[model samples]
Target: MNRRISVAIDGPAGAGKSSISKVVAKQLGYLYIDTGAMYRGITWALLDQEIEISDTAAVKAALDHIELQLVPVEDGLRVLVNNRDVSKEIRTQYVTSHVSQVAAQKAVRTKLVEMQRSMASVGGVILDGRDIGSVVLPDAELKVYLTASVETRGHRRWLELKDKEDITLEEVCRTVADRDTMDMERKESPLICVDDAVVVETDHLSIEETVQKLTELIRNAEKGERHG
Candidate 1:
């Protein structure tokens, strides 16, 4: 059997990291680990308990009591917090707005990064998040920095959640911009492209095209690894 390779996809918010990583993982038969969901899971739990996200101590305290699990399902992975499925809940606008604050906590990042490392240790995993390439999986065999224009990213997100929420495209665009600033400026594991990571610009690419491009990147990486 061929050795399983770890893939890291890192990018700013609404850059299609989640969607693209999922397809790439499916194509390569690798486990898809959405690190952002883990943070969102915690954020949802914090919101459920009414804990202020900016209060690092409170967030860390909450983390001590909750368990986050990502279980693979037919459609995709289901995120569970304290054994309760919060897969849908975490994507809410409230959680989306507060997730960056919660994720920036040092203790939160440390714990989640540990969990992420444990999962990727087995290889054959595609982990996507702001810091997957820089912090969680620094030595991953394949590191891809996927990005798109803020307008494009916001438009994509608006399309995904517009029917479910009472938000406008402009609002989503502002949120995306805010998230990019937070993720980049955060003291802990800020979003950045590693030196060796291949950058994929997806501003104009279709979903299938993006997936196909990443799939080929993985295949080429594998071939290079074998030859090396």
Candidate 2:
């Protein structure tokens, strides 16, 4: 029997990390760990409890009591905080606006990164997030820095949000740019493509095409690991 391996996909916002990772995981029979949703869950909890994100002490205190669970659903993943399902709540505009800063918080990252590491320790897991390959799972069997042009990512994000929000394309593009800066400049575990990670650009590739490409990389990695 072949040993299951861990795959880490890191990328910027609007880069289709979540969607691509989901398909790849399903195809490979691996557990997909939605690290971004975990961060969003924390963000939602802080806002729900009225805890100021800038207040580091308060944020650390809240972490002690907060509990998060990621349950897989037919359509997508469901996030639960303290036993309460906030799957839809975490995707709201309010949470979307504040998630970057919340994710940047050292205390928040520390707590969540530990959980993410534990979850991936068993292998056969595919995790996509800003820092999965760089920080959470540096030793993942396959590390992919999936990305695309800023304009492309912005347009994709805008399309995803158009039906849910009354935001314009330009505004969505600006938001994606702003998020890129935050994710790259943040003090804690900033988004970066590790030296060993394979960079996969999706500027012109369809979701199916991108998935096919990554799936091939993963299979090759598995073969190499087995023979090595």
Candidate 3:
């Protein structure tokens, strides 16, 4: 029998980590945990209450009212906060611009990391986030750092948001660049690719191509673990 192992996929925003990881988990019949969505959930809740995120004390207090859950559906995962589904709401421009600030909070990271750790304590789980390989799942059987050029990522993000937002491509690219700097420079669980992580650059690859590549890597990882 093949072993069921934890897989950690880490990368910067708009790098397709969440989308690719979701598909990979489905193909492998593993549990898919979207750590980024959890942080987004917190960010959304804070905004809903009109709480000032800069006030660390208020943010810490707001955590008590937030209850996040990731429910699986035929289409994909549905993110819930306090029993309210905010899957689409959390992906809004407001949350996207502010999630980094909320995520950087020590209190937010502490609470969400605990939840993430509990969800992945079992094997056959795949998690995608900034610090999954570096902090959340250091002992994961396979660690993949999926990335692409900032321009590519920005273009992709712009494509996703063009219909919903009134932003220009240039503005989207600048936002992506700024997010990269903030994510890399943040003090709490900043985005990083560990030495053991396999870096996959998707500058020219289609989604299908990337998924196939990761699926093959996962199969090889399982075999290597069996022998080792």
Candidate 4:
């Protein structure tokens, strides 16, 4: 690699950003970050401490003590919350359900965004989250907004949750669309595509193709910066 560049990937649920971001990071020898998981880890912390999701004051206090760490691993990232390994715990359905709520808090967002910025200051990171390009790291070398039709994204989520639970495509579509609307309509920081961000519609794309597209974007960005 000529130079390490930070990549920001923003997308709604089941848009294939996480998997493709990981693969792209690995191919570029960069650190991969799932910002969604950071929120999930925070939710796990709050739940483990029995903090009410709606109690903003207590939630902020609890967030004061919890530490979410993203450690580099060979294949994927290892997520740690407050010294304990809550990687698997954060992925539970409970955490998934509450993560958006926890993340919507301004105080919580402030803390996590600070942590994310500290982690990505060194570059060579591919971060996937709702606000990475829009709010988290606006100056990232390359920003990508991944998207797909609600029906397509829903079907993908259905397949992913097929073995885990009995979720139908119709239910998946409704949930996915609802989540998308919530993420975009939230008052804290609506998920929006920022200037200079590349929009990639992943409705009919493979993970490999998506990764290649993102990697090419980063390469071109780096090349332009060097020449300019």
TM-score of every prediction relative to native: 0.96, 0.95, 0.97, 0.92
What CA root-mean-square deviation does each model show from the true structure? 1.7, 2.0, 1.7, 2.3
Residue 89, candidate 1: C-alpha displacement in angstroms: 0.7
* Ten residues in sequence with the least summed lDDT for candidate 4: 219-228
Model 2 C-alpha RMSD to native? 2.0
Q: Which candidate tops TM-score?
A: 3
lDDT, residue 46, candidate 4? 93
lDDT per residue for candidate 2 within 26-127, as digits (tens), equals 998889999999999999999999999889899999999999999897766889999999988997767888899999999999989999999999888999
Writing each residue's lDDT as its tens digit, candidate 4 over 29-49 gives: 788888888888889999998
Q: TM-score order of candidates, best first? A: 3, 1, 2, 4
TM-score of 2: 0.95
Query: Over the stretch 68-123, how does candidate 1's per-residue lDDT look in tens digits?
Result: 99999877899999999999999988899999988889999999999999988987
User: Over the stretch 134-153, how does candidate 3's per-residue lDDT look in tens digits?
Assistant: 99999999999999999999
TM-score of 3: 0.97
Task: Note the residue pairs that clash in candidate 2.
Answer: none
lDDT: worst 10-residue window of model 1 = 219-228
Question: Of the pair 2 and 4, which is ahead by lDDT?
Answer: 2
Candidate 4: give the clashing pairs. Answer: none
Q: Extract clashing residue pairs from model 3.
A: none
Task: Please give the CA lDDT of all the candidate structures.
Answer: 0.89, 0.90, 0.92, 0.83
Q: Which of the two candidates, 3 or 4, achieves a greater TM-score against the reference? A: 3
Worst 10 residues of 2 by lDDT: 219-228
